[model samples]
Target chain A: MVANIRDKAAIVGVANTAFSKDSGVSELSLAVQAIKGACDDAGIHPREIDGFATFTLDTNDEIEVARALGCGDLTFWGRSHYGGGAATGSLHQAVMAVATGMAECVAVFRALNGRSGHRYSQGVSGELLTADAIHWGWYTPYGLLTPASWTAMITQRWMHRTGVTKEAMFEVARCTREYAVSNPNAFFHGQPLDRDTYFNARMIADPLQLFDCCQESDGGSAIIVTTPQRARDLKQPVVTVKGVAQASAQGQEQMTSFYRDEISDVSEHRIAAGDCYEMSGLRPSDIDAAVIYDAFTPNVLLQLEAWDFCKFGEAGDFVLDGNLRPDGRLPTNTHGGQLSEAYIHGVNGLVEATRLVRGQSVNQPGKQVDHALVTSGVGIPTGGAILGKLD
Target chain B: MTPEEQKAFEDRIYAYVGVKVCERTAAKDAVNPAMIRHWAEAMGDTNPAYTDETWAANSRRGKTIAPPAMMYAWNQEGFTVTRGRASDPQTDMVELFNEYGFTGVLGTNVTQEYFKEVSPGDTLYLEMEIDSISERKATARGIGYFFETLATFSDQNGEKVGTQRFRVLKFIPQEQPTAATGDDKLEVPTRIPSPRGHDNGWWWQAVDEGKLLIQRCKRCQVLRHPPRPMCGECQSLEWDSIESGMEGEVISYTCLRHPAIPGYPKDPVCAVIKLAEGTNLVANIVGCDYDDVFIGMKLKGRIEQVDEKTTLPQFYPA
Candidate 1:
């Protein structure tokens, strides 16, 4: 059935632009820059890249990015829906294309001037578009406009179910910022965030403080993928795609599944995480480092629990106990995560996982990261990957 | 930065918690059709409920109503007076921050929770209180203190309409107010109830008359909270509304802690109710701490006259 395409493909190269609030360039330029950089890093001619993959949020289309990269006509072009939930989906498509002999070289990229172009935190200026707008029409009058508002609804229940206090989320901000202060690439570089400061940062949404949410950074990231046999001759170490999966629960609504029995459930990520584990034959204990998505502070906790890294309703304590630290149980988001690094739609976390698999991460855990679990954006339809050293 | 010094400092800042800052300040203008039109023009909103009288009359709202997003417009101190009096909690808090070299102030975020609709002639009165004050901290901007204020808006009859949670950072910025991340004069939207040609216009009409009406199916004698045209059990089209004591129990709930909702901060959507008769409805749990609310708790529904267009059901511990 080809249910598990284990070790069929490997990530040969990855590149990320400096994360920032304003890039002062078009999203198209960002995509081209990242794609070209990845191709160069992979030592692959632009023409060798025939497939294009990315999420729905990016402004640039596959045809435009492919054309811009001078990567002749594309044979495979696909995108995943649900904003950041499709972070690993681009890689999943790349893997499927290469494994099935549909395409030789696939370039997975995500580029968006989130801050300069579509500042999500400031709220939208125009009329609501998209068919989802009609569904949102039912809740907008209640003030559920921004993504944070939708998350706030779920977070409320998650808190009630888990007994996880708002205080526990602050630790995520502080820890990620602590790592970010050390990395020059982080928006909070040189800006240390202590627990008290994190607490003092005003609440944007209930349970979610200002720092609890991720920075709306403008950035682009790309990963190069090909058949594991072909990747043997690539420029960088082969970070074999051990497993990849995407999933959605029965009652999944982008972020608002308010009518469900368990409103606190992030079952989509759990379902995706299960697929990754089943396909890779790697348990949670087999993972050395993880790059859990941190679009919001609580998202990390939810992903940690959803992926079975910690018990359900116990991620808050796992995080508070310093488990996600560089020296802790599992060094997570060593690139400072979307919370501190950048929100490139969770692609940056995948880049970090690739780096970990290559043993080239800037903040490499004291113990080398042989296997890393890279999760996409949580709290919605989600996807994930288990990246490991090419054995 | 010393712990002892920080302790003393925090102790002093903590003294202002829960203090009533602003005496009831009336909105400069009562909700009126002209004000609604002005808001619609500013927003380029073409919603018939906000502008067209004929369309709104035929719609579920029965008449033009103010947008929930514009809930704060009525209470805005805009270009007029009451821009934080000297003794007001807001002014005092700012002054307190200034004394600590945190002379600059910028809004971090704001959250509103809307419960009901507001329309013409609804005079809004706002009461402000110091929700919380954080310990001093250093940032890229400079040293700062974040203080949050909760403002409750009600009408002349003291029926709460909404609440607003405003969090502001009083900082000595390194530069001018961190160049607003692309704030190109876009007014945040005010939400109004989506009144499509809903089949239950009579129910809303009854609410306007200060009555809590539940639709009853004549064929099978079953009551429904949301008035649907046909009964699910009997497939009956004939139905009538009957007034009940408006009592229920807390079944499930969510606390909506959003920065800014269209209306005022009704904070924590509170609870979903399983009514005394039958059927479920969502409403806020008031008159008690939100954290204290639990499933199976006895609750009684209190309908508040939010405006000429809306009467909202709010639940309190029975």
Candidate 2:
């Protein structure tokens, strides 16, 4: 069982570099910039940081980022895997480190040149040498090469079983784009999406159009985790880490897990949600806002079901009923999510979730956000975290 | 034709149902390793039980056993398939269809179930009957009538070993469309090759020789795919292999359309196939239209040399 660490750690600062298609800088420079910005927000010098956590896919190394930031020797350093699936899992590592007194301050960061460098949308190309390449080899020869294609395999089956159509998928895209229209940091800002344009967009994979996919941006995001007592003296209002969890179910794969008994279900999300809720003593009804990963529009709907916000097969109706709007029931992705916002993998969603808990969102919901839920990517070993105002 | 004439034609075809296409015919040769090996190679199956004498002697089965899917090989007529065959109901029905101008024939479906295992020296006999005939229906190919045949096999001791059902469509050929005259001819791109590595090199080598081998733990008998060195179920370093039957159903599928990658069609139907041997692999659904693929659609796979350097398993509707 996961040890209860509710309110034990706090995120005192959250910062992100300008989201862009091209950064014109190295990933190490982005990392240093984001980390310096986060430390500045917390009213601390970069040299004060003593620990670090990040995703394994991050090109920037820990010692290099620490050296560039002039940080002291790191005591607690950790990294998680599966790309965006480990976005919050990296934070979970920091929370554990701070709560257990292993480190005084831990900075979790993700920096990438996803666009101008190695674009994931280009699909699998060149030779793959990793062990993960073995299973990927099974599909690449069949022309199932892209992340969108892997996701569509499950989305297609989900639609078949639930009788949902592209209309519901469009609602998810439209709702997130609505938030992006007002969020100045979002890549889709000021670019409103109409149903005509969405329907006219070329298909990336069956059931997934170009608009449904997330923007591959070159950007960086950082968060500072420390003891709740130490966070009370920070520059920003303390936002408590009420709960955090990472889980992988049986037969889990990196987005290609089709062998499970229910191919459409996100079992890892279910396990992680169960642990997160139990740890925080919160339920789906307690969450006022959510930053569910939206690498693709269909993921929002599937995650809505997996998180138990609504029962399975009802997310189509949930989104179509306008429940994601500011005055609506859930008010999801207020920062536009990865779909409309720049995709920093998923760490950008974490920054938005932190903003929601701090009551500083540009498109904050009308209701008070006492607790906000944020999740990493699905279709792999994934995780979720809950943030709330310090008691 | 008028409704009455259509009904008359359907009735005449339906009359052949329950007609014996073949009486009990003995196999020309007994089950042996040479034929088993040849069958395994053709089907791309590399189950050690079929050919590895030493491994089979030490394994649980204790001796060599033919793959259960090879039951039909024993009864084949080989080079003289047309000469030694007698006039049967199946031929008469085909002749009748040909006379009516429903001349194009296509094998659409086949399913086999095994009961008793057949090993070396087992002589098999076969009996077949026309199972059913459907009314003429329009299909993507043309207007066609479907007929099913069922065959049962038994060992020399007269115990049942297996049974097979085969379905074929006889149709009138559709008018061929004119070939494209555009100068923008689509160049066929070689498929992305499977990444052969230290762990999975043997599996790809088997595919080169037309075989699909599944890594199996020698101790716990657990099966692992993509050829890993360690079995997840049991922490065993010792392992062997079993050849897949290459029979499966589409558990899930997708059609990729955007950013048209090289080495593929405009839209290719890719599927996750749950093999009959209780494992799954991703492969292309070929030999059929993309729209025809569905969850739970039965399929049969073949290891084909798709490009200059790529040999992969491609599936067809079964």
Candidate 3:
């Protein structure tokens, strides 16, 4: 079931720490600072916030956040799993809590020390030694253990099935960095990448160059959600929650979905996109702009195909044609995404969605953004949310 | 070292490559709740679902679920020396190289991947197989021998669960003189005793009685080594201690020229002996040279009483 928060709840405030390779602060401190900045941006007191939502991987506890912010009481607290997939889901939970009278005001936050702390790019190891960990035993024995290696398997299969070239994948990375160059807050801001640079980048996993993967950054971002009436009375114009949905396909494994019927097609994205579109009462053509999760460049194309934004295997051509550019139809990741911006588990994607609705984005698209779609992590049980201007 | 010794060393080196020993128990049902809780605490996951049963009932997945990463938390149980006793190194390769005398070994990289969900109540059957063995010329860490081993785990129904590929590097001691391999002869004793017993103040009393015993479920007739309370096959609590013949045939064997485990003698010969009663046991094959321990070799079990409290089961050619 989908809960429509259109004109009922809105994101009135948003704030984030500086995105960088290393932010010399604890994750908790970053979270608290982001929360305080968001609250201040909305001109609301901390005592008014009654709900909190964040990622399960986030180190900041709800109670601790409340204590740090001097919040009076919390009526709703929630956490979403599946890494970057929970970015929009956290907002969805906050919006639901505010709309249903579960909480008067809800705050959604994500704090991560991605680079200097635990780097997922280092590959999956330690604490993964159980019976289930043995499944990768077959693949790792042949030297395929990293996340890029896992995704490379699917990318290779996708390439073999479709005549998509490495040039097509590079185009996606190029477009993302292009947007990043214009985003002042982006870690790679002012730095643009080209096809040659993308191809020449170090090979992290086979077929996946270093630039194809997202940059690990230490940062925190927070968004405040309140009822439309309350949001209208606050500092910013009410940006309605059009629709949100989370989906997990059958035969799903955590990171390795190799046993699925089709590895190239992300079934979770297809299912989530269907639900998000149906709930929003909109189609792919209706989305003026989007923030497609870019944990990996290939996943961006996969999301486009799965959501029917482009036909199957047609995303390579669509992306190459500058369809995802700010001037093109359906501008995506206007804030550089996880690839160019600091990846805070897709939280910054949601922030970009809010910016698109508020018309405050650095890489603002030409057309009026009536609807902005945002997606969560791609490989696992992903999530999606749509934001629209209040009627 | 004579030419025969060098030939024996080469033979041992070849046999150690891609060798594996299987643990009889299944993966799914072998989960220990206490162990899962401990790992969850270590990971700093305070989700009540892993601890509180009431909270778990309301969880999205319904039942209490172990954290996704908790499935890889099984302590490595090494090869069994006797019916109920096993041998494991006191320290890991990294720890031994870091603190102890093996100084040359450095630049260690470990990579692991996950395949399936290791839920609670799943019995885990583990099989450790040596994937490859390669020797590199003297690096900064003396002469290094790289051994890659893959451990495959399966559930009770024999469904493949996960796999672990471990790369171990053993640095040769600088002062240790290169020993002749062929001169190392396998020693076998005449009489073998059964290593088994119930906890009656002393755990391994049956080994002193000169009989090998295994706990058998009377209802299902399932014989279980490393005895537990109930029969994993039928979940029958009614069990009787049964004595089996010490003689068995080797299903697979490996002669180790490099010490994978620290403090153990270098080039020790290990074999997975399939007992006549249809159970496989892993132990050192004694009383035969490294060249003689081949697949399907017949061997008889002998009890080597280590001290007043412990007895090790050693096997030799029958």
Candidate 4:
């Protein structure tokens, strides 16, 4: 029996810090500030939040967060693996906790001093000795250390099979950067990347130029999830969680999946997309806007195909046809994405999802966004969420 | 000296090519977590893996390892070496360049190859070899010898851990322009082996003595450009070293432009030459016109001084 908690749990408030290269503060401070801002937006006292959700890789702990917020005894706390793939999983945990009567109010957040602190852009530099490091040792010896290098291998094969050029990547950057110009919170605001400038950027790893990779940023963002009854009692409008899902394929290995027969198979995202549609009882056409996880732009196009937004080899055409624009059939990432705004993992997208549903986004499209689909990064063990406006 | 006479003088010095000028040296202390902490503090990197104990214990990396960029720190000799050997080749070369009015010196580029992570308590030692020296070249910075030095790092167990190829320019501060080289002259650069571990360092040692050495597995008789400790087919560590006639042919080549490696040509020709010994090795395609670099071109390998400490095996069109 499907003990569905559809629309029972909703995100009543969303808040984000100014995204930038250096936050000049600790990650704990950023998290606490964002959570406080979210509680204020929801018109709820800090003591009311009884649960918290964050990434497993986050530097902050729930106990510290609760202590900082002066919240009562926690009723629920959870985390998920995979970088941005865990963004929607956080909301999934929050919604479950609220729907099951385990917690009355939950704060789902992601915080990082990614640029001012330990930059993930450096790739695997001997963090510690682990089984994963042992596997990477086989290739890292040959200078294949960065994420761009690992992604390049998959990109080369994909380009050979399907005719996707570097232009497809620039299109995503161009769209997001163009939108970011108006978004005050976006790091790339007012610095729209032109075609010539995009092409002129150095190629860090082959097929993936400097513009193709996402910006490493420092910021915090939080969504306050609560029971629909309690959320309706609050002053702000409610953006209810319609459906969310997480999935991983059989031959999943964190980021490097070249060992499998189909190296470029992004089936895990397909599974999550199917689950989201099934749980929400909605089709792709019902999704008015999309907040996709774009750590690298090529993966963005790949996820579009995996989620069935476009045909297998037609993602390039879909992007080139101005389908991702604000007035297109499905206006996507109007708040810009990781490639332009900031990489707060997936919380920035979730924050944008809430805004699109509430009709408060900085770059809100002319069309009504009754439903927004937010996705995590496309690697295995990924997740997604479908948030709907509660009339 | 006129540009032509300077060229002939450089040719005369090239005959003294295969000189093992510097001996092997070891660092003062082994790697430690304290060094990692000090480095992280200076750089303001509060990565818990480098400092916090509780996090590293639960993290994927079981214990803390030294930063990859800290490879050179393991065996860094202080400002003045306590065990500085007399008759240092680098000093002699610097003195020679100073005599020739080429006094300016600057570090250009560094390429490092790490085979394994270095952990606390693991001691490392590096033996450096001067890989190559450029003919007199003019740069905006000055005119100088672009010295390329290759250092082979090994653990206390004698396992080859990594290698660092560092290039430096010892040039003279000149205002006037100097005439360029011959049309067939390959851009002068520092040439070092892409990979040379303990088993193959002796081949480079032989090359420094003006001998083009090849490694042959005694068990399998298969030859390899990089003289590995073991044979690919037979898995035997024992091998025989033989001197080649330094003759080869270019099998493939590429012209690099961006991510410019300093001291080398802005547009350099990198060639993979198959020796007469049936082994293939990568070397700078020097002494040829940039457009004229082609596959299957007959070539010969020669020894050239890279720095005061090391010599490298280079190939030119035969």
Winning model by TM-score: 2
Write down the RMSD of candidate 2 (Cα, Å).
17.3
Residues A117-168, candidate 3, lDDT per residue (tens digit)?
A: 8777745433353344444432332223456656765675676567788887
lDDT of 4 at A158: 71
- Candidate with best DockQ: 2
Q: Could you give the candidate ranking by TM-score, starting with the highest?
A: 2, 1, 4, 3
As a whole number from 0 to 100, the lDDT of residue A387 in candidate 4 is: 93
The stretch of ten residues in a row with the least summed lDDT in candidate 2 chain B is B180-189
What would the per-residue lDDT of candidate 2 be over residues A94-175, giving only the tens digit for each residue?
9999999999899999999999888888677556756677778777888899999999999988988888788888988988
* Residue-by-residue lDDT tens digits, candidate 2, B280-315: 888888888877889899999999987766888889
- Ranking 1 against 3 by TM-score, winner: 1
What's the DockQ for every one of the candidates? Answer: 0.17, 0.45, 0.02, 0.03
Could you give candidate 4's per-residue lDDT for residues A212-255 as a string of tens digits? 88889999999999988888899677899888888888657666
Interface RMSD of each candidate, angstroms, one decimal = 4.3, 1.4, 15.4, 8.4
- List the candidate 2 regions with Cα displacement exceeding 4 Å: B1-189, B217-223, B230-238
TM-score of each: 0.68, 0.72, 0.58, 0.60
* Candidate 1 chain B: 10-residue stretch with minimal lDDT: B185-194
Tens-digit lDDT track of model 4 for B1-318: 896978875775454344444555666888888888888888888888777767778889777777777788877766666777455566676667777777777677776778877777888888877777765555656766676677788888888888887777777775543454345332333322223445555765676688887888888887764555777679988889777887987654544432343433334455546778777655566667656865568998788764434465667788
TM-score of each model's chain B: 0.54, 0.56, 0.41, 0.52
Q: Rank the candidates by lDDT, best first.
A: 2, 1, 4, 3
